[model samples]
Structures are given as structure tokens and as C-alpha cells.
Target: MIKWIAAFLGYFLFRFPGAVLGFIVGSFLDNFGGSGNRTRTVFENVTRQSVSPADFELNLLSLCSIIIKADGQVNQRELDYVRQYFLSTYGKEKANAIFRTFNQVIKKREISAERICSFMVQRTRYEVRLQLLHFLFGIAQSDGQVSKAEAQKLKEIARYLRVGQHDFESIMAMFIKSADTAYKILEIEKTATDDEVKKAYRTMAKKYHPDRVVTENEAIRKGAEEKFKEVQKAYETIQKERGLS
Candidate 1:
């Protein structure tokens, strides 16, 4: 039994660096943040303390790898984009942890597309799923335009995530609609006064307030939540620019 467990552990340790590393980083961050109890329930009810690092790495790589492949190439800019994003969102320590795991996962030669697809299909959170989609969209736009292959891959990923066609369209629309260079969110004109911003916020807040939108369709709820976040971020950006808040 000892030998058997040891062999199993070795196999996984060799196979799945990302999953194990993700679990470790996740667990460590959970502990560090001291809010594991209040975090997404997916981690809360997990039965096993020892998660396969490779599996976790594969999952993340699956998403990222697909995005890279979407453009039919993986350029330095895209790689830097992922690195910087992880650093900004998860901090250097956690990002390093994930990078270590991904490094191992990729070392396994000839990673199959089927396996990669399955990995993405299994892992990732519902809410985070949206964020991942957003990230993919961002990646697609890294070169100032998305390629046909990239577009199709994003759509395939969306389908795998069960994100409806309409939802996918809307998500893309949000990004595409902001064709301007202004940092302001909501895309309101630069000349807009304080009162105009206030009215826009009030209008959006009423429509997207979580409580108010709870009764709407799931797609609507999700869109509203994302939109609301955009609105809040935009409002904050404007305030900072005006030195009001």
C-alpha cells in the first residue's frame, strides 16, 4: 500500500505540475487571505487536500494555449500579456506558482488537443468563466485585431463553457463598442459634465443593481453584473481624473 500510494503520487507529480501548483497557490492564498470560508464554495467543499498540480496547470494552459493558437501563433507580446495579467491580478508570488506549474505541464511533450479541451471543460469557475472569456477576448485583441482562427477558437471556447451565442456577441460588443482611446468607461463623451455622469450612473445602477437584476434571466444577470462592474470602474476612473474621489 505504501509503495502503491507513492507510485501514484509520483506519477501525478510528474504529470500535473500546474494543477498541483494551482492547488497549492490557491490553498496558500486562501490561507493568507484568511477568507477561505467566504470564498467560492467550490474550494470550500473540496474533499481532497492533495490536488493534482498537473491537472490544474493543464486546465489553465488549456485556456491560454487555445488563445495563443487562435492567432495561429504565440508571440512574445501575448506571452508578456499573460505574465503581466497574472502578476497584476494574483500577485507575483501566486503568478510564479502558476508559471512553475505551467512550465512543467508544457514540458510534457506532444500535449494532445483533446486532453487540453477536456481540461478546460472540467476546470474553471462559473463567475471566473466569464473573466476567462474576457481575458481570451483581450488576448485576441492584443495585436489590435483578432485573426479568423482566433475568432473561431474563442467561439469554440465560449460554446464549451456553455456561454450562449447571444451572450458571446454581447461580451464582444462591450469591447468593440469602446473604439475610442479615452480611459473613461461607459464611453461617454469627454465634454460630459458632473450631472451628466451622475444621471448615466443612476440609470445604469438601476438597471444593473444586483438585487434588481436577480429576477432576470441568467444571461441578463451575468451581463448586467459585468456591465455594472464596468460602470463602477468607469465612474471611479472619471472621479480620479476629476480629482473628486
Candidate 2:
């Protein structure tokens, strides 16, 4: 009853994620109704929507497959990277299940970027989606260089996911190295003063901090930490170049 109510209210107020969050909270409330004490639900974050592990894995693999196929021919390294990352993060059993689903469903059919982004926008948090973009960039760069086709596809995916231009550029900078890459990672302009650069670093540090991704799994939080480090590196690089160091 409570779950249904949350689903209704959440859908009306938010969207897919709202419903998921409602259900998770509802489960807690329902359980509380029966017993005085409450227990935690296994959906990634406590403050965010509860995306089932299985479902999240399936959809995530689907997205990876899309990226792998984006550049015409698939690279063994890219495929191995995805498999190895999942294996290390989720463990053998879960990774096996994820691959099974990938082969049976995701690998077989061509899932549209629109469909994936639509689900992500409605059901997931902005932070998670940002991490997703970062992961895709990793795939594009796995073959040593990100092809023009792969880069274009990544941009399309980011747009579909409703990622802001600055944020998109920020993630893109982490993979595509250039003279102004530092500024892009900080999501700032090149002409910004020292103070402004520091400010951007602080904002980005807080935004990409692993703590912000507590609702996600350990692997994903680790990924956030990696992103946070990139932001730190960018800031330091800028500081040195500008003689602030």
C-alpha cells in the first residue's frame, strides 16, 4: 500500500527515479509497520532511487555494448576492459550473471541510445549518469585513441542523458587531452583568474567526491574517487602553469 502510494506520488513529482525511490522508502515503511526496528534495503544509495542490482547491471552492459559497436569494429581491449572491470567490482557470480544477461538480451538486440537515456533521466541521479559518461569515455579511449565516430557517439549519449554542456566537456576533457584540458575538467573558462580557478576546483571536487556517490556500489564510488582525483590533477596542473604553485 505504501509502496504503491510512493510510486504514484513519486511518478507525479519526479519520474522513474522518484518511483524507485518511493518503492525503496515504502519497503522500509512497510517493514517498520510490522516490526518496530527497521533494516536497510539493498538498493544502491539510501538518499536516492533503488535501482535493482540485476537491472542496473543489465542496462549498464547494454550501454557498453552500444559504445563498443559505435566505432564500427569492436576492440578486444575494450570488451576485456568492460568484462574485467565488472568482474573486479561485482565479483565472479554477479559478473557471470551480468554477462549472461548481456549475451541473451543486450548483445542480441540493438538498444537505442534514446531508450537508455530516457530511463537514466527518469530513474537515475545526475551524478550516476555523469559517472556513466565517464565510463563510456574510458571505453572510447581504451583502444589508445578515441576515434571520431566514438567521440561523436559519446557526445550524442551525453546529450540524450541531458548532461549539461559544461559537465559534458568536463568528462570529455578527462579522456581527450589538450592544452585547455585542465580548464575543461574544471568546467571553467581559460581566462578565469587564479581565484576563479580555485573556486571551480572546489565545486568540482565536492561534486565528484566519492562521498557524493555513497548510494552507489563500492566500484562506482571508487570510480567517483577517480574522477575527483582527475579534478584535483587538473587544478594542480593549472596552478603550476599559472605560477600559482
Candidate 3:
């Protein structure tokens, strides 16, 4: 049993050093090397507590910085967009602190979007991942358009996060408006009838509804609300174009 636990810890320690360390140190006195049942319980508790809201925000901002630098130059529009998002979501005091920390982290090392996305996929909920994708699109389009480099980087991050093509395209459509973007945003075929479009819109809205997000964090809920609004706009655009409303 100890061998099994050690092996498990060893595997995760490389990938999640901080979490594994906390799990080990925090459980050392209480449950380390205890009965199998007690050890299992401690393991479950530690796993559940591994990723906190602060951790999520840091990873998100770090990845956002990576996207901002994808085009080889950080434009003022991208920086302004990030600052505004942080201020709105986290408030001025917290946002300023987080923004400073993120800038320092980015300057210290080159972050790998794949690594960040992989970590997020393992730690975050699906709804949170979708919201992160929405933010990524926002960053990509901050400078008026998503350059080829930025678009490809976003695709790579999406793939690493295990986001489906439909979801990726749906979020992309929200940022890059076009004749068929509304249909793509709703994940419906362009040839679909009015009823089919309506059905698709309803299903997507339900899936992305802000209330569907299970987090207690207001920032996360606010992000989800934005996504919900984007979904609503897509449906409205489609209906108006087809004269269905």
C-alpha cells in the first residue's frame, strides 16, 4: 500500500510539485502511512483541494499572456484588453496585483500554452475550460483581428485542452463575425431549417447558461455570463437573418 501511494505521489510530484508537496506535508501527521482506508480518504481530500481559485486565475492569466505574445509583439490593444478584463473580473485592487504578478512570471520564463492547457484540462471544469477558450478568443481578436500565428496558437491550446472542434469553432465564431459565424456559434449546419436552428440555439444556451457553472467564484460566474450572452447574440443574429423572429 505504501509503495502504491509512493508511486502515485512520485508520478504527480513532477507535474504538480506544489500540490503534491502540500498533499504530502499536510497529510504527514494525520494519514500518511495509516490504514489503507484512511490513506485513501486523505488522498481524495487532497486531490479535491489541489486546484484553488487563485491557481486557476494565475494559470488563465499566464496563458493569456502567452497568446498576447504569439504574434511576436505585444500590442497596446492586447494589453488594454487584458487589463480591462482583469479589472472588471477581479476588481481594481486585486486585478492590479494579479496583473503585476502575471507580468513578472511571463518575463521570467517562456510559458508553454500546451503545458498550461494540459494543466487546466486536468484541474478545471468543462464550463471553466469553455470560458477560458472564450477569453483566449477575446485576446486573439483584441488587436482588431486574430493573426494566422495567433489563430494557430489558439488551435494548439484548444487541442491540448481536449476541447472539441465544435466547441472551438463555436467560440471562434463569437469573435470572428461572418455570414456563417452565427450558425457555427450555435454548432448548427448552415443548411439547417429554422426549427433546427432554434433547437440548436436552445440546446447550446442551456449548456452554456451562467447558472450552469458550479463555482462560487463571482469572477467565474461573470465570465460564464459573458459566454451566455455571446450564445444569445448568436441565436438572435441567426433568427434576424432568417427572418424567423
Candidate 4:
């Protein structure tokens, strides 16, 4: 939710600055940009009304709490990353409003991970779920490195989200670098032929293309673009190792 959602929200808000503030649960805070800006109404309604805010909070916010608790201790860096991300993307007023709602959700009841993941797998698109994992890894790794406990929790979440092993490993390689990370990110064997390597790079590039998630918010698209960049980096690493053109 932080990275993808933040990226997409920032991108769309830029294009339509007015529609961005409508996210507040009730009333425009501190007033609108100007009396002349006509897009103000659109800003409030163009996004997420189709998707229930309560439902969105219950799932994504719940996941954030679980990740913050994953490594046996809550890290303030992770907390700040989540907070600043929302504040920067949604603006102070909206972000504070979201935190209010989030706090309410935490206080009122518990939403099981099984049900949350089930809702995600059944309701959200595959590409979005992929970005969800991408964002989750970002959270886990925010404090510098993802601990073993955090990594295990991530794996469990991936399985619950029904992410394939190859896809899961590909995303994992982006955060947890290793000698063979390039190969894993590209989903290819190091023993593959030169042509196979080229083909894998092409496939990954296409698969992670930002356009593939066009329907996603600007933040999700940004997350997809980051994966696309990682794919490019992985290809470059292999190319340099093998001296491919």
C-alpha cells in the first residue's frame, strides 16, 4: 500500500490536483484550493469510491501492522516510512484522516489474515497482488535489511496471496540481493544459453511493464515500474557477467 499506492496517488494527484483531497472521510479540510478550480469535485469522487475505504483499510492497514510486528519488534523506521508515505501522497489532512480511521479499525476488532488474503486473491487483480508483495517487501526492508523472521513472514503472506514460487522469488531478489539474484529475478537458470537469457529478459521486461497495470492507481503503477527497473538491472548484471551485447 505504501509504495505502489503512494506512487499512483502522487501521479494521479499531479494530473488532477483537485481530485486528490476527496479521500477524506468527511468534508474538505481547511477549504479547497480556490473558488475557480473546477476539478475539485472530481478530485473527491474520481478515486476509490468504487472501492470501499473501510474494506481497503481493513486489509492493507492490517497487513502493515503484521509486517511491522513480523521481526519480533516494531521498528520506528518502518513506522515512519508508512506514515511519511501516506502524508506525502495523500497530504497531511487526508493522511491524518486515514490514520484516524486506521486507529479506529485497530481498536474496534480484528480481521484475520486468512480472510484478508482471501479477499485480496479473489477481489484484486494478479498484477495488483504482485505489487502488494512488492510493497510488503519494501516495508520489511525499510529498516535497512529484512530479518530472517520478516522474510519468513513475507513468504507466508506470498503463499496466502497465492503468488507462484518463481514470481515470489523474483520480487524477493529485488530486496534481498545475492550473487545469483540476477538469475532469480529473471526467472532463468545460470546454465541457460545466451539466447535464453535474452529471451528471459524480454519476457520479464514485458511482464513488469507499468502499462500492464494501467488500471491501478498511480502508486501501484510506480511499484510496477520499479519492478520493471529491477528487471532491467538484473538483465544488465547478467549481460556484464557474460559480455552479451
TM-scores of the models, in the given order? 0.51, 0.65, 0.63, 0.70
Error (Å) of candidate 4 at residue 63 is 0.3
Off by over 4 Å in 1: 1-54, 89-97, 100-125, 177-208, 213-226, 229-245
Candidate maximizing lDDT: 2
Clashes (candidate 4): 8
> How much is the lDDT of residue 114 in candidate 2?
74
**Candidate 1 lDDT, tens digit per residue, 1-245?**
22233223322432222222223335444444423332222122223443343344345565676677655566667667666655543558866876776555444444444444444445544444555576677767766776778778778878777676655664665455543312344445667887777776677567557677553233334445656786677677677777764
Write one digit per residue (lDDT tens) for candidate 3, span 3-71.
234324433332222222222222332343322331121113223435433444556677878888888
Which ten residues in a row are the worst by lDDT in model 3? 38-47
Steric clash pairs (candidate 2): 17-123, 44-215, 45-215
Cα lDDT tens digits, model 4, 50-115, are 434444444566777778787777688987766765676667987787677656544433445565
TM-score-superior candidate, 2 or 4: 4
lDDT of each: 0.54, 0.69, 0.66, 0.67
Worst 10 residues of 4 by lDDT: 18-27
For residue 166, model 4's alpha carbon misses the true position, in angstroms, by 1.4
- For model 1, give the 10-residue run with minimal summed lDDT: 37-46
